[model samples]
Target: MPDSLDPSLPRIFLSAGELACPERPSIITTVLGSCVSLCLWDRVRCAGGMNHYALPYPFTADEEPNARYGAWAIEGLYECLLEQGSRPAHLEAKLFGGAALIPAPQAQLDIGGRNVALGLSELRRLGVPLKARRTGGQHGLLLHFRTDTAEVLLRRAGG
Candidate 1:
């Protein structure tokens, strides 16, 4: 893939609690606040995927593991790429989101901080090297991820 994004490439909007691993070239875009998005790709296979997770983990024991949580989202995206013929050793990651957009007292709750921490830890646990990141601020973000090329374009939203 080239540095330029081809206009014909399909575009998909990723929402919180969702993940996408396309078999073909595509552009995945999403907006984020406290939510986090992890973009993973296999350098050798040219395959990639992305996940948007709202929380670091389930708050209760009865909660079923799902993509809405960081742990599950990370693992699910990894598995999806692997199933798409990506090898673990070739995986690289880019972390995004985790902005402290809430006001005052509520901002102190630090869901963004927790999200960033969990994302970093999970990537390490998976043995994926983080190639880049745009995290931690008082504003939201918009991301444009190219699946086949593993290129990301980030814009600070209302910063």
Candidate 2:
């Protein structure tokens, strides 16, 4: 599919019971693994959006939804920001995801680390400043945000 044909450019959708905002100031929430969820907020405009992506790029024919990839998911978030009238130079970000959810001692690959690093790098490339972040752990997260108030609620699984 062409870049413009990507599914992330449209309005919000529900996947795995999570909300993904692809336009305007919309509240979205979800859980993730090595995958990352990025929250983009335009404080001056009092608007924000979020995206939950399984992989950095489109999954291969044999792969399942790997929400941990930064490539595909980040692109979706960017498209949403643009659609919301966010000026690339005027945007700010809050990042989450990349949990080392596997039990320690058996934890090997640092998927969370990669996700966080890529997320930060992408934000910088887009000229958005990363204002806050919570990443790397052995637990899942339930995220909530209200675009009107620019408030984010983070609930850890079973907590």
Candidate 3:
């Protein structure tokens, strides 16, 4: 529904390992391929945020946790929305990405599946109701999220 984002609003491209939660309205976009993005919005406060992560978990115990991992990204996005005056109970979530773009053998780990699983579990843990989702397939996706309305427009990447 975000036709072109108000030309005046800031438009941001969310790269993997990045998160954005602005106090004002903006348009946030990202591309996904086996990566996952957790989009959050608080209806009561009219605040929204998004995060992109490439891996399901941190690689090491000593690794500085950040938005690059599912756990950290979810937590960060939630906290960011909270800081914007949104109540925890009012948060609604939308999940996307985690496509198995490349073929994987039966025994091989499905990174896309794991990423989706982690995102769902984390949202449940935070008590955020999942309102929408478009995930899991062989093709990549391009996502555009409107922070003011929490509306998302998705298209298959390269389609």
Q: What overall lDDT goes with each candidate model? A: 0.90, 0.65, 0.90
Which one is best on TM-score?
3
lDDT of 2 by residue, 26-73 (tens): 445566665677887777667677766554444475654334356656
Candidate 1: which pairs clash?
none
Worst 10 residues of 2 by lDDT: 1-10
Off by over 4 Å in 2: 1-19, 22-26, 57-68, 104-108
Please give each candidate's TM-score: 0.93, 0.72, 0.95
Query: Model 3, 50-146: lDDT tens per residue?
Result: 9999998987899998888998999999988887788999999999999998788862478888999999999989999999998899999999888
* RMSD, one per candidate, in order: 2.2, 8.6, 1.4
How many residue pairs clash in each candidate at the backbone level? Answer: 0, 12, 0
| Candidate 1, 1-159: lDDT as tens digits | 345567689988999999999998889989999999999988998878899999999989799989999989999999998887888999999999998876547644899989999999998898999999989888899888998898888888764
Please give the distance, in angstroms, between residue 41's alpha carbon in candidate 2 and its true position after superposition.
1.1
Model 3 bad stretches (over 4 Å): 1-4
Instruction: After the best TM-score superposition of candidate 3, give how far the Cα of residue 63 lies from its true spot, in angstroms.
Output: 0.8
Candidate 1 is scored at a TM of 0.93
